[model samples]
Structure formats: structure tokens, C-alpha cells
Target: MTEALSLVPTTDARVARAIDLIWREADLLDRREYRAWDELYADDALYVIPIDRETDDFASVLNMVYDDTRMRRMRINRLTEGYAIAAVDAARTVRTVSRFVPLAVSDDEVTVRSAQILVAYKRDHHDLWAADVEHVVRLGADGDRIVRKVIRLVDSEAAVPAAGFLL
Candidate 1:
């Protein structure tokens, strides 16, 4: 039998903070707290859920979701308006966010990569979504905020359910 892995002590305070922020974000999304989730982003944040695994150029390729700050605000408005068809039958999500590895860390920015498993339940249907999420968090004068979030879905090329809320 394999031995249980022991938790290693993390040395960097920034990394700890980033992990906390990521977990809080995931919790907010799971709770459908969109307004609070939106506050975690920087003014010019870019959120992308790419359709193609090989392409990072959102402008040139078709993406599942690509939203700049204004577009993100519109999305939040649409979700909160109660008129969006996708939101009408929105699924409740339970997200498992783990393996938060800090790729890069600095005083001004922190780049982290993590794995996410989202289980969504609506009506009688349940869907499982998995992805590798990359977050570029910028350290603002006031606090840390996400500047970019790229969600590379493992089965992005396959057909998936409508994502009405933040992921």
C-alpha cells in the first residue's frame, strides 16, 4: 500500500494568500454570489474559457467564454437580471479546487495553476466538469485582484452544458 502524503509547510505568505483567495473565489461561485465574485477581479481583468486547448488567442479562435471587464459586467448583469434563459434553469455547482501551485510570485503579481472539478446538478441531471485553471493575480494598491483567468477544460472539444454562472 502507498503511504499517505504529509502536508508540506508553505514558506511564502503571498502563496498562502493566493491559495486562500482562490478557495474563496471557488466558494463564491459555488454559492452563486456573483457580485462578490466580481469584486475579486481587477478593473481590467480578462476571463477566458477557451474552446480549443491549443489556442490562447481568444480573438482569432472561437472560445466558450471570453469576457473583458465590461463584458464580464454585462454577464453579471445578465445572470442577475433573471431573464437569461441559461439562468432560468441554472444548476447548483459544487466545485473542488485543489493543487494550487504557484508558478510565479512577485510583489506586483502572482501566477497560480490549479485543478478544478465542478459537479453541477439541475433537475434530474448531473454534469461533471474538470479543468486546469490558470490565474494571474495582480497586486493592486488596495489588495490583490485577479487580472486574468484562463480555464482550459479537459473535454473542451466535446459538447458541454450551458454555464450560466461564474466558473
Candidate 2:
């Protein structure tokens, strides 16, 4: 069995909280609520899509996308401010995240693994992007915030189409 699906889902309160946040994030993305999506992350969060499937040292390795706070802000700006390009040409994406596997859970934090199938529609074509997603959530007293998100696309080494929406 694959590591991601080896473990079963849990009913822990912390896990529920983390999964709720993740689902909310997914809803925000589908609704094109970029600002709300931005608020879901912590200040020290890392958003990464690595080309190397096995390496976790994203800082030292090459990545398709590695966004810190500043970079993420800039990218969001490009998409939300520049023009209606993102609205017009950007693919309409609807993503399903399931098969929850709690990697680590604690009172202060939770790291979960899940499967994400994102369907993007552009013009007359519909494309599917399947990935294994790992989310590290910091459970704060006020609310939980995403500390790190790593999306590993199944076709990372193949020629992938342009994604008009954020994964």
C-alpha cells in the first residue's frame, strides 16, 4: 500500500478542525475568493510544488513553485489586480479533496495527507490534475492556520497544461 493511504482517517477533534479548515480553503478557491484564501495561511507558511517527487528539501532543490509570504503576495496580485485575464482565460476549477490520512496530530498542530482531484475547464476542454496533498495546520486558540502546503502532482514530470486556478 502507498504511504498516503496506509493509515485510516481519525475522528479526533483536532483532525476535524484541520480538515474543516482544508475544506473551507477548497471552497474559497472554488469561489475565487482569493483574499479569503490568503487569510487561511499563517505568516510563516510555505506553499510548494516540487518537481522532485521524493525530496522534501524544497528549499535546497528546484521547484515549479516555491512561494513564501512575499512571493505569494506578488502572485496573488498578478492574478487579482492585473486585468480580467484571470477571469476570462483562467480555467474554472472545481476540486475534490478526500481520502484523509492523518500523518501527525497534536493539540497545537496537525499534518494531514489527502488526495486532490482538480478539474479545470477552459474554453471547450476539461483537464484533470490529480495530486497527493500534504497540509500542516497550526492549531491556534483563535483559529487554525495553514503552516505549510505541499502539492505533488501525479504528472509532475509530464507536460502539464496551464492552471488558471490555484491548487
Candidate 3:
């Protein structure tokens, strides 16, 4: 996928802000800003890592290790608390976002679908993962900011070691 931008039937300001937010997230993740990254999420948003079978439902498999806002915060805190080894010696990572297509836009909710490629280097080893992530952001009722943002990783059953770093 390519980082191509298209004009949809969305408010120019909102679309611009969304793209800016995504880019900021990319920068933060690359810089290992765990706390700042955590703060970007909504208070009650959900992070779902589904099994690789092409299903979004997480009721049975329960593929989410960090599903709720509180859990996500704990994950960030754990990273900073020096409990997770990957956090202590974090991997050098970068995420390239592409094909940012706006699927739907209600009054205060917008859905962005994009493909991302994340590369990480750890201890002279490199790992690259590519997947499409759906970002559901609920713009505040006052049209000021994002109220809720949901992230669902496409490859949640890849048997990877630990997902200590954000994509």
C-alpha cells in the first residue's frame, strides 16, 4: 500500500486532524513514548487483537491481552515500571502507514482503515510485520477531539513472543 491521500466527504479540518493524530502516533511509537502513546487512546476504548482467522469477534477466543482502557494503562505502567523485559530494553521500531481510507463518517464518529508495516530491531535481530488496522475514532460531540479510539490488529494469532511495543 502507498501513503496516498484522497479527498472524501469529510470535514477538512477533521480529516486533517485525524491524519495528524496518526502521524503523531507513529512518531511517538518510534520514539518509545509509551506514556504519551497510552494517553492517545480514549478512556473506554477497546484494543482487540483477533486470531488470524479473519474474524473481529473476540467473545470466544478472547485474543485481547489489553482490551480495556484500564488494562492498556497498566500495560503502559508495566513498561515504565521495569517489569517487562522488552520495556526495559525496548526494541528500535518504526511504523509506516499507508492507504488511509476513510470508510464511514457519522456526526461524531469516523472509521479509518489503513495498512501498516512495522519493523523492529532487537539485539541485532530484526522483525517485520505487516497488517491492516482499523482505527475507530469517535470525535467529540463538540467536534473538538477524539473521544474514543479502537485499534484492532489484523495479525493477532501469529505466535509472536511478546507485544510489549506498540504498532
Candidate 4:
């Protein structure tokens, strides 16, 4: 889905800041830097991967993942402490997030919609996952924090191969 920019794309430098943070996130995930990745989110943040493509009510709908801070921390522990994402299905991945459309920009917040394409290689097989991702970032004196992230998978209804890495 192509989203026409709702605001001037280059007028505000906050948009650029948001993109830079997003790129940093993608890199941390690729490198399995779970600790650093965890710090990017706010205390009340949500990280969601919803099965419903058109739904904004993520809490009431069925989702592949709906993680609050506690849940996210648990997931990170599983991925880092043990072998949850490092075991049999361990895949080397490279992901690119682009096609940015700034939906909202303010002094204290920036909302962005973008496209992400990820490729994971495991056991001589390659898998592709594509999604439209939305991020709501909160600007702060300390640092910018992600307050919400919703990843809508392209083939949500189809059977996707199991992935060991975070999307």
C-alpha cells in the first residue's frame, strides 16, 4: 500500500530523526543486540504484530504478537538467556525498512508509516517477510522512545514459515 505523505516530508527534521531511530532499531535486531533494542521503547510501550490488516483495535483483535513492556522483556529474556531464537530455527537475517511516510509530526511526537522487507536464511532455505509498519515515537529530554509499533504482515492469513528472529 502506497501512502501519500499527509505532511510535508522534509519540512520538519523530526521526521528524519524518527527514521534514524528506526534504522538503528533494524540494525540492533539484525545484530541480536537485545539489550540495546529493549532500551528504545518507553515503559508503557506496545509492540504488536496484528493478524487483522485493517484494524486499529489491536487489543481486542487476534494478533500474532501483542506485547506490553513485561511481555517484551520476557521475550527478550527468552531470546537472550536461552536459545529461543538461537536454536534449531536460527536464521541469519537482513531487513530493510523504507518507503517512509510521516503521518504526524509534533515537537514531542512523530508518527511514521513505512514498509519493511526481511529475508532470513536458515538451513539452506530462504524465507521472506514483508510488512507495513507503523511507529509512534515519543520525544523526551533523555531520548526518543517508541510508544507503539504495529507490524501488519503482508500475508497475514497465509501459513508463514516459523521464524526464530524478531520481526
What is the TM-score of each predicted model, taking all chains together?
0.90, 0.92, 0.80, 0.92
**Which residue runs does candidate 3 get wrong by more than 4 Å?**
1-11, 141-155
TM-score of 1: 0.90
- Model 4: C-alpha RMSD to truth? 3.4
Residue 86 C-alpha lDDT in model 2:
61
lDDT of 2: 0.86
Relative to the unseen true structure, what is the C-alpha lDDT of residue 93 in candidate 2, on a scale of 0 to 100?
A: 88
State the displacement of the C-alpha of residue 20, model 4, in Å, after optimal TM-score superposition. Answer: 0.7
* CA RMSD of all predictions: 5.7, 3.5, 4.8, 3.4
**Compared with the true structure, what per-residue lDDT tens digits does model 2 show for residues 127-161?**
99999999999999888999899999998878888
Model 1, global lDDT: 0.84
TM-score-better candidate, 2 vs 3: 2
Over 11-117, each residue of candidate 4 has an lDDT whose tens digit, in order, gives 46788888888999999998889889999999999999988899989889888899999999998888777656463357888999999989878878888999999
